[model samples]
Target: LLLDIVRLKGSHSAEHIRNTTEQILDHLSINDKVYKIITDNGSSMIKAYKFGLSVSDQNFEDEEANDEDSMDVDEQIGY
Candidate 1:
């Protein structure tokens, strides 16, 4: 569903896209309810959702560690 359409007046970099998406989710109070986001194969889109939404206060290091752990688990399970 299309909830809102915001008009931005600046460069649409990865940071800008991510910030705008976060703002919209926060404004709707659905940050915790989001599971996945679909976007085109643009570079900015890929970078914006590289770590998913910042639903909590997790730092980049923590996310990297978690990703490593998941990879290990997947490797062990022959995934």
Candidate 2:
């Protein structure tokens, strides 16, 4: 069982969610490749990601995302 916990402030839109998720995935890929990633019931994240939730598969995998290195500019400025 592997999981990457993402702490998001307030809420997000679908486009915003995709952008954020992509950033995390890109960072994670630097260390190790992942078969899939998962997130909770947040509307934006859930709708934007293809591999959201459902960790019942045999191929479930995880890799830590270096969020500190690639922070979201919009989020930092309160967008």
Error of 1 at 63 (Å): 19
RMSD of 1: 5.7
**How many clashes in each structure?**
0, 0
Q: What is the lDDT of candidate 2?
A: 0.57
1-79 per-residue lDDT for model 1 (tens digits): 7767998769989999989988998899997766568889999999989988755545555667889999999999999
lDDT score of residue 10 within candidate 1: 100
- Clashing residue pairs in candidate 2 are none
Error of 1 at 15 (Å): 0.5
lDDT of 2 by residue, 1-79 (tens): 4535577666677777766666776777632344455668777666776555333344342122334324566578876
TM-score of each: 0.63, 0.39
Clashing pairs in 1: none
TM match of model 2 to true structure:
0.39
